[model samples]
Target: MQERIPRRTLLAGLGAGLVLPAAARAGDLAAAGWASARGGEGGRTLRVTTLAPDGPGSFRAAVEAAGPRKVVFDVVGVIDLGRKSIRIREPFLTVAGETAPSPGITFIRGGIQVESHDVVLRHLRVRAGRDGAPDRSGWEVDGITCWKAHDVIVDHCSIAWATDENLSASGPRFDGGDTVEAWRQGTSRRITFSNNIVSEGLSHASHVKGEHSKGTLIHDNATEVLIVGNLYAHNLERNQLFKGAVHAVSVNNLVYDPGTRAMHYALNAPEWEGRAWQVGQLALVGNVIKGGASTRPDLPFLIVEGQGDLDLYARDNRAAYADGRPMPELRVLPTTPLPKVRRLARPPLWPKGLKALPASAVEASVLATAGARPWDRDAIDLRVLRQVKDGTGRVIDDEKEVGGYPK
Candidate 1:
């Protein structure tokens, strides 16, 4: 699932949702960075009255409605997508899963993709399993992803069982841009992926690329992406990857049992063979990564792979093994070639009024408040959290391994 639309094309297609109010409320942004901008404020209320994927009063209908809208839900249960996804094309929208009755809402066998601007998604669960699709059958689904979408905030969501990434912000690498700044503006910008539980991306399940289990991919040219206070558990690799020319921040995140790698940066030579190479900038602060049963030995806290130059600022990041043994902070595998890593004196893009918790406090803080409706967690979420605490889980090939969805 790629979004290849050029920047100009996307701008030309903007509709009534682009006409947003001038002043945004302070509460809308609180902890999020540039993405703190308001979404659907002073807009119409559209209630999701059914668990259907489409038709009247369904989630699809509410999201597809024109203009700025705030989506509230009266229904609470698992919304079986029947193996399809809900693409949010309308802008200035807020899907507040917290507005639903008791149990809240969960989407099974499908996912959500944000392709518009000024969107806020909160307190939702998305478990996009393979649904018995054949191995390598191209049945790829992301829990929630944003592409060519800006000013978006996806917070406190429980996302799992995806054949692809559990959560990500991605788009075209370069959309006919003459300079580096133009390239960044062409893709997703000002996005916040905060306080989410991204886990168990299905390995060897349904992606066309075999054995691809990833947590998040902040693709090339994506700018101003803030990944904070999230719990990334049981994904094989790409606990989060910053591709070429991207600007991102990873702070106060708890990563457990990442198989081969934890956090990495790469820019493939083939992807930018003839184009001008743009440098990626990243800030890593107060984060924690712990190796578990599935993790390989001597894994670095941060790995720079393939081609491309990167400017990085690292401070107070910590790593440990399953049994509480400390690990190297910047150790790389002996055979792996390193990319050009330039050190920065200070953070280039820190969020406003953001005070990162100490690395020692990351695990407790993330586990307690991360994911959708932390007060009312489901069986699968509780199981994953327990495994992370006890060091007892590995990446799986199917949701059946953990007992499929709830009845």
Candidate 2:
């Protein structure tokens, strides 16, 4: 249990920019990893009074309001987005979906896009389905994507049915300044995607690029990313892919039913045609990957592709088939082989207080704590978790296969 600190003292320390201790971090479950230090500490409260996609008291309205604020919900159930996303451009904001009623709040037909800094999002569910759009109609939506955003934490949310990557950190690969470090800083950095349930991304849906049932894409140049304690299920590929120049740590995640691919790294040559190549640095520790019905046979834990190089550190990552048979740890594409995918003796970067659970314990821990309102899970989330346990889910083309949206 978390010991309570006085509101006065907490605010005072926040104002003083004091790094919170582990006990203090426990007070707010959303505070963890690289993003644990700062967020909307002294913000005004903004209440979401309706489930409408947009209006005076809608979720969209509260997020778009000026200044630092913590958005709380007065209503629950789904917010039909009319197949359009809500863009959050303000800095120092907290969207506290856990403050809602028992069922909590859910967004359908669209998702949230974070384009600012110092943001904390928790306990929300974004079901960004195709919304009856024709296949290849270019209606790509992500279940909470951060673009060039920093000091952000997205925790315990349920994301599914996305046409594109479910939860991604993406931006201009090279921007801001002259040096490589400056370019990395210009994009999304210091972001945490933790304890979330990312599942059932729509395969052969409304994406313009054809089949794109992806999990999470840490885009090129994004840095200081921490992905821990999340459940990735029934996604076709990109079960969290790290592009070139990305520095990320993925630990203790439970991945199930990832078809053809589990975790991957790639750096497109055309995307960096004229510029110098940047190597991706990644550390995968204590993660559990179990193949399901949709998964192909003899798939390794990771597949590296594209033209750029990668420095990787993998430890205690367990991969198994549905029948409990072991699988390989790493496989590079034949096109990009050998030294292009270098194995690192030590981790490239490690967060200050990240405690990765053992691979054997990842499944139980994530199933119990991941996703929105785990104590009061929605029907869809419950079904997904059950299928994960039974090794019985598939990559679907539509949400209707899983009974569509919740009431």
Off by over 4 Å in 2: 1-27, 336-339
Clashing pairs in 2: none
- Cα RMSD (Å) per model? 9.7, 7.1
Tens-place lDDT digits, model 1, residues 147-262: 88899999879999999988999888777577877778888999999888999999999899989789999999898899988999999999998888889999999999998879
In the range 1-407, model 2's lDDT, one tens digit per residue, is 12233444333432232233442222255436676425567988999998888889999998898888988899988899988799999888888877898788889998999999888898899998988889999999999999988888998899999999899999998898777988888899999998899999999989999998999999998989999889999999989899987899999899999898899898877797568888889999999999999888988999888788998999999999888898888888866333287789999999986667777767766776678766567878878877887778799999988888877
lDDT of 1: 0.83
What C-alpha lDDT, on a 0 to 100 scale, does residue 338 get in candidate 1? 55
Top candidate, metric lDDT? 2
